[model samples]
Target: EYPDATATDPTIVPFGPQEGESLSNCSTKFLERIRDWCVNKDALPQTVDVIKLLLVERKKAECRVPTHPPKDESTGDVPRAIVEAQQDEIQFPDEESK
Candidate 1:
């Protein structure tokens, strides 16, 4: 007799390390980049949260999954001020190059 599976079925897909890249090294590099960018931008608490969320989305993209299915890109847990700051930084990145 086969048991009925629930809606939240945990089908595990084992992911091995990418060619020449261990998971630990990849994670370390990812976090270091995030930290450097955040520090350069003088990130607030909300900005940190947004950065983390973005990283998660990027990971999902790498895994060939949908990015943030429930949450829309424009709307997240981050504050409006932080979101605005991030937008401004994107638009005026040259200012930081000087």
Candidate 2:
């Protein structure tokens, strides 16, 4: 456990201000608060992370056009596997038979 409340010592910047293409691009700082929330089962910071986020900002000049999947021929929109998720299902309530 952290002492002196370093975890929440400084409240994180409001969510709206943190909105940016990347953390480095945001005018506000947020990484410290994010780090505070990460820990292992022993309540200790885990050094061995299975996956890590590496957000880096690139100059607009250096950015390249991203490839996208073909859009639906009829709808002219990108196809989503589900209404909400890449792979998800939408459920409807069953109506009672008369």
Candidate 3:
């Protein structure tokens, strides 16, 4: 593609490192060049990776098995919102990866 065409390409945005999927299959040289072009390497937010969240959500999405209360044991049913509130997820990179 020509230089003018590349400049107009929507995929060539500035937020390349904003998500893991954006760099998932990228070449090593392309990765390095993107790193070099970073305007603010130190201003990222303190939050979970978008890719990890998407993966967890995707996994949950695939688990389409509808849950039901046991026929013989339950005296009362817990609300879905309360059960969901008790569950949480987090991810942290190991020491060597940073």
Most accurate candidate by lDDT: 1
Clashing pairs in 3: none
Clash statistics: count for each candidate: 0, 0, 0
lDDT (CA) per prediction: 0.46, 0.33, 0.36
Candidate 2 stretches greater than 4 Å from native? 1-40, 43-47, 51-66, 79-98
Q: Is candidate 2 or candidate 3 better by lDDT?
A: 3
Q: Can you write out model 2's per-residue Cα lDDT over 46-92, one digit (the tens) per residue?
A: 42341132222222312431234356799986644222222222322
For TM-score, candidate 2 versus 3, the one ahead is: 2
**Candidate 1 lDDT (Cα, whole model)?**
0.46
Q: Candidate 3 residues 47-81, lDDT tens each? A: 23534544464455335323442232464755433
Candidate 1, clashing residue pairs? none
Q: Could you tell me which 10 consecutive residues in candidate 2 have the lowest summed lDDT?
A: 16-25
Ten-residue region with minimum lDDT total, candidate 3 = 17-26
29-75, model 1: which lDDT tens digit per residue? 55666677678888767676866775675566357532233333577
Q: Compared to the true structure, candidate 2 yields what TM-score?
A: 0.21
